[model samples]
Target: METGERRTATERTWMFPPVTGWTFDQVKDLEVPFDWELVDGVVVVRGETALWHNHVRGALVSVLRAAETGPYAAVSGQCVMVDEHNVVKPDLIVCDPRGLDVFEVECAPVEKVALAVEVVSPTSRQADRVRKPALFSANKVPYYWRVELDRDQKLAVHEYWLNADTLTYFPAPSHPVHQHKLITELPFPVEIDLDSLVGF
Candidate 1:
């Protein structure tokens, strides 16, 4: 029994070895349990999501899905190919419905995505707060939202819209943060009541 238990643990612990200088194709071919992103030829494995992460993500996805009218659809944990060597999976993504398949095994083109949302987890703070926004803006993703859980466990939404000329994000000229609700016109009109949405 002890030997069998040890073998089981070892088998579960075995994972695809991380590689440097990998392209999107190489990363995609890897059969790992965790989602992966190719960041400038380096493979970054996504951390396991926690309960609160899913709770916040579910709330946002529900709102976005309900508001979906035409052409646009919202999804969670879909990969977006930024370039030949960059693929990222946002927590929630809103994009052309035609671009996604039933299972979402294939990555959606960055150009087709209207909004990319990241719900910050303890391990994902730096990447979500800094790296992803820059990458999304550089790819002209048009809209970006960062959801944060405050000390009091209330959700705070940070909104940004890409500046076409500069290819960077600027706070939506309207309400940008923690206004109890978000009302924006770009990527089509969207109004969400944050307090109620998060059940806070």
Candidate 2:
């Protein structure tokens, strides 16, 4: 008979926000769960963010909807994928219209996305700065944005690409942190203001 708390090795489950690894059938079997991202076969649930984080998130959504005008679509805190075990929920996502397949009823594939962004929540900063970039680069994602909320008592912006090993951030000589955008070669080019996004 089982004893000592009856420990059992449970197979881990993985997912990329909104859509989980469980098929519709598997999902139906689950009674309770929260949003999560599976990276390197490890499942990591998104941590609850600060009010400032939420404020920045909502602000970005608003800016994308109201100020930045273009054919692109902006998504907030939606889980996306780089691979089966590598899933992420970006604070804000700006994608090319061509990548809409990922947002379909069935959801899009990993490579379909053009850009992925992460807002630096007190809890998520390390994963964003260290873990995600390598995964994104390995997957050949063209662009990535990292928003830092704790530096100098103000918001800081950073951007990366698969081509470079290190990340280049905002407050650029030509573009201030607020003026940066995630530009791409897609037919309908779209950009987001980093400063305005996190509410500087």
Candidate 3:
């Protein structure tokens, strides 16, 4: 008997093969029960985001699309290829309008992304704050914003801008935390009422 061996399914109802690492293009085809991402050649599954998290994403999408002064547009949960071995699905992405039609794009190239946003929740603290920023910054996504539930349990926005040379994120210089209203010219000039996310 060998330590590592295979098992026969026989007449089992369902069997999932042992798989490791998935390319960005192949991820969309996986019919799994939960939302997922591919990291380090493995499919990592996490429960779906909270309802409030999605509501905030939806609101930002509308705001960014309406405020677009360029050819970029906002979409929620679009898969992005971070590298040959990694694919990330951001909570929201503002990206170039090209190659965005259905049947045309399975996952967006990292170069096409303008901004990536993550709305922080308890379950996603590490992924949103640490892992995602590191990945996005290394890939040179122009901007990243983290929407958070602050100490008062009210929504706030933390903005980060990427430095191409260092491959890292620096907090936007002026405001440490953006709440109530967020007005910015970078990443296509979108204005949003942060508090409005909860009204949905």
Candidate 4:
């Protein structure tokens, strides 16, 4: 099994920190400023999410906090398992607090989450909207949210939920805070105020 000191390197590929048989404790003790989410035995690091991305996160966190009361927790920006080679660092994650245990060094065994949110940066829009939706659904996460951002701190909220055949997202009806567009499926009803979310 690979250890922190034995990380292998290859050109032009994202670093795949070796943790083949390392314990969660070993993953956490690594000397790095970035937060990591481990799936199977691979490490995924999160780059800086843009400022507008954060603003939208704060908005949803407020709504989620007000409407629910339970042991479940809502967090913005954390990595969770998507599959053996695909570890995803969602913009926001809401899951059982008890499951934080799964986030140890080399693995997190969570399969479901109360909610998952991703705010789009130009650099990550493709990954956020297309890549993650498939991964989240394949893993059966219950709820997924996408917040799209454009110049001037403008934004859009796209909500997704499980559908019988595939995961889908429902875009807002009015002109988007940033005029972004999407398609989605949300089992529970949601009233998204696009303007307010982007400080219009």
- lDDT of each candidate versus the true structure: 0.77, 0.56, 0.77, 0.58
Candidate 4 regions with alpha-carbon error over 4 angstroms: 1-26, 36-45, 69-72, 83-86, 97-109, 150-153, 164-192
Residue 92 displacement in candidate 1 (angstroms): 0.9
Model 3: number of clashes? 1
Q: Which pairs of residues collide in candidate 1? A: none
**Which has the better TM-score: candidate 1, or candidate 3?**
3
Output the worst ten-in-a-row residue range by lDDT, candidate 4. Answer: 181-190
- Candidate 1, which segments miss by more than 4 Å at Cα? 1-20, 99-105
lDDT per residue (tens digit) for residues 32-142 in model 2: 356556555445667887777788778766756554446556778666655544557777776555636554533334576566667877778788887876666666666
Q: Report the number of the highest-TM-score candidate.
A: 3
Give the number of colliding residue pairs in candidate 1: 0
* lDDT tens digits by residue: candidate 4, 100-194: 55545333344647677887777677778787777777777776777766556555565665553665443334422323333232323234555
TM-score of each: 0.82, 0.65, 0.85, 0.63
Candidate 1 vs. true structure, TM-score: 0.82
Between candidates 3 and 4, the one scoring higher on TM-score is 3
Worst 10 residues of 3 by lDDT: 1-10
lDDT of 1 at 27: 48
lDDT of 3 by residue, 60-175 (tens): 88888888866787888788877745888888898887755757777788999999999887888999999999999998998999999877767999999998899999998886
Judged by lDDT relative to the true structure, which candidate is superior, 1 or 2? 1
Assess candidate 3 and give its TM-score to the true structure. 0.85
Which candidate would rank higher by lDDT, 2 or 4?
4
